[model samples]
Target: MDSPNSARYSSRRSGETSRRHRWLGGCRDANPDNRSNVRASSQNIMSATLHTRESFDHSPVMAEEIVALFGEVPHGVVIDATLGGAGHTTRLLEAYPWMSVLGIDQDDMAIEHAAALRANSADIAQRLDVQRGRFDSIDTFLAQRNIDSISGALFDLGVSSPQLDMADRGFSYRQDGPLDMRMDTNAQLSAADVVTGYEVQQLTDVLRNNADERFAFRIAKAIVAARPIANTTQLAEIVANAIPAPARRTGGHPAKRTFQAIRIEVNKELDILPRALHDAIRATAPGGRVAVLSYHSGEDRIVKQAFRDAESNPLVQTVASPFQHHQSANKLVRKVKVAERPSAREIELNPRASSARLRVIEKVGS
Candidate 1:
């Protein structure tokens, strides 16, 4: 993967530009991919405006699978842990008119959007509770509200559209925004800090371990030389410039893996995911279900392992029911099902759905 900067000469070639754009377009078809591009194209739009009607046309990943895990609508509260843009929340409210939702997000902007969404819908307005906090603190948040044991919970993990689309968030290398990629803008750490402050080896390890970037060492060397990266475009450019010409075009984007590594580090996303899933499972009542939609291998690994561990406990039993119907409460899905991707039709409509994978577990043994 040639860093965009290193290959600026080649990138300008008509053929190279076309190939890059085509690859980008393929990735963009998924909502997750769109968010990456939105992060890259952040300069033109406000973060709040980044997620307008046009950006939200695609359905969420595995909507039916999630609904099935949730089973027939139960008469209790449910949590949407990540609650990005409230897509899943909207569906839940529609499917189960009686259910109340506690939609939580680390990002204040997401909270704002969810609140507005609820306000616009009379039914959701009455049933929704929006909180601005990390999902890892879900138990504490619920306790504060005098609520315990929700009937269901959902986690749509990873960057939301508006976060990437808005350049100020600095999540995408493609978009030129301040190198600040904090999911919670209030957080002190930012992508700029990583690019400018970390040691070469440290940065290399981050790219290699977190993102599996093959050219981690070279990219790290380039980034160290281009210190004090002020914004997304410059950092991405530096990374792109680092790769040898032969190695540059190997991957779709020379900076894709490096950017992913930096963003994950900036947000502390992987670090907290396992803990959040475990806590979510514990927070729900026995018979309650927790469904997670992960967009990448890193996120899916944590969800898969956590659910697997839960099923091994004597307290948790396997749900033996057929796939389409609801399984008994107190029983979880027996195995980690294949990672489900967006349908071809869905991918066409919302390119961002491509990388999505959904997994679920139900609490048993009261």
Candidate 2:
């Protein structure tokens, strides 16, 4: 995979020009051979050398639900753990004028984009503090600031539409770009490393566990056979060809799951998520809320388990005396129900919101 700096240099040498546009750009190409051209055009719109503020434009999924959850909390700081494009954070700040937000994200581009937005809007600038780091280190950030607890926290999990739209970032399977998919540009491991290095079984496990891809083993075998896969388009083509034609026709895209699994592995997303949720619950004030918007079953499952474990002890308490026994507990922010999804209207407007599922929980005792 090419380094970001090199990608930028190459993009300029290729005579590409950046353009302002919304997120509806990259749909799958009908002609497999022309997929490379589609990726090149996307590259032109989001040149690696220049990421215009407009390039980060993304519509927050279930914006009203997020605002409602955080708005009900008493006045205090709110943490936006996955502050991609600051869409949710912006709405959150507007809804709760009395509250402030500490926005955290691993992506440098996201942080830069947020800073640019802050510079333009004085109201947003005054209330939002941007930080570049992973959410799992929330405790460290809080300690540095001498803060004890926050009123609420929001975790919007998975890749954002802007990231997918930017072909150089390589999150999209449909676009032909470098295999690099590190959320944090400074991160050592990349999707390219996983694709080029992982053993067949390891790759299979990643696909099966992270994405629930039914053809994990077959895909892994194909990936191994096509060693040193050059770009997203090539990898996608390989996976598509490896799958049974009938099966490939039904799913939205055959490469979607493989790309998701690779990105998850490269970023260690699932490994860090459990610790991040624990930190959020621990750092939140009593009665404070924690809301998560997950885009896939693997992420949703992790959130569900974390909420369940917080509400009940995994082991039975041996002591008979209730007064003597000590146990931690968590409360549901609202009544427990099936995770919320975007409305048909939202999906119609932004197809990316189709798979989103929102879940909320709260801290119980002090």
Candidate 3:
């Protein structure tokens, strides 16, 4: 989830290295002896060492579910598309002795952190190979690696916990920082450019499309009026002040959606997501799986549509309109019915997991 970076909009879209070659370090197993433990059914599935955050302390959302989702795939290289802190990758490596992971992330911090993490264990260090780049560029990555396809891929979308916790990243509206929200620190576009550059309509569209901000127009207008908006706090204040008082009181923060919109614009998150998903689907071997853990409506809708598009023949979908529930019969991919919500206990333990939504599809044949 390349989101706002924290509990709210943890969606950060930054730019950096066109390619981060490898960050194959590891995490010390928190539960070394109990890596294979699993509780009852999926109701509250928990893996002893698998669910806890890595030494990096960033927990992966729906860890148990992620493992189970990929468990059925043909054992081979699985792509951890958003390898923030490598929590899910570590879990997957521990759970599936036969599997290796090709982790990908644009954030240098995540890649560096993962590199250092793998140093703790040679097992994962040997199995995990990380690359720094937008996940959507999967095609280029596979070509460079001399790999033809993958067994599975996982997309955990959003800004990472560390990104939000650190005020310098400018992802938290509650804190004051420079208006920078590029997931890749090296990326050219920054939140500052978006806040000060986009016109009212462009900005409004971004707000509406990225985060579905109801006060998109008002917020955009207010932002334009407050030209030299200084930093995150000021932007947050302006956004809050522009919203009707009643609406301000409900959402956790009036600026959450605004920040999300800006981050998405800065990173071009929505624009490239479809290509990324489709690329992953295309690169998947027969019986392989592609799983996504999106954090918001916009991300979810795109994931749903992409999966539907893969499942349905384009010619047949035109007729699907008359029958809204029309089921498409195809052989390329099939949905994996999964209960993806965070368990109440999981939410209680990590509130950031509240908005996580996981979707999975399996490649049926070539």
Highest-lDDT candidate:
3
* Backbone clash numbers for all candidates listed: 20, 0, 27
- Candidate lDDT scores, in order, read 0.66, 0.70, 0.72
Q: What is the C-alpha RMSD of each candidate to the true structure, in Å?
A: 9.5, 11.3, 7.2
Q: Lowest summed lDDT over 10 consecutive residues: which window, candidate 3?
A: 315-324
- Model 2 clashing residue pairs (backbone): none
Return whichever of 1 and 3 wins on TM-score.
3
lDDT over C-alpha atoms for residue 105 of model 2: 93
List ranges where model 1 is wrong by over 4 Å.
1-58, 317-333
Arrange candidates by lDDT, highest first: which order? 3, 2, 1
Q: Which stretches of candidate 2 lie over 4 Å from their true place?
A: 1-57, 313-335
TM-score of 3: 0.83
Point out where model 3 deviates above 4 Å. Answer: 1-5, 8-55, 313-339
Candidate achieving higher lDDT, 2 or 3: 3
Q: How many clashing pairs does model 2 include? A: 0
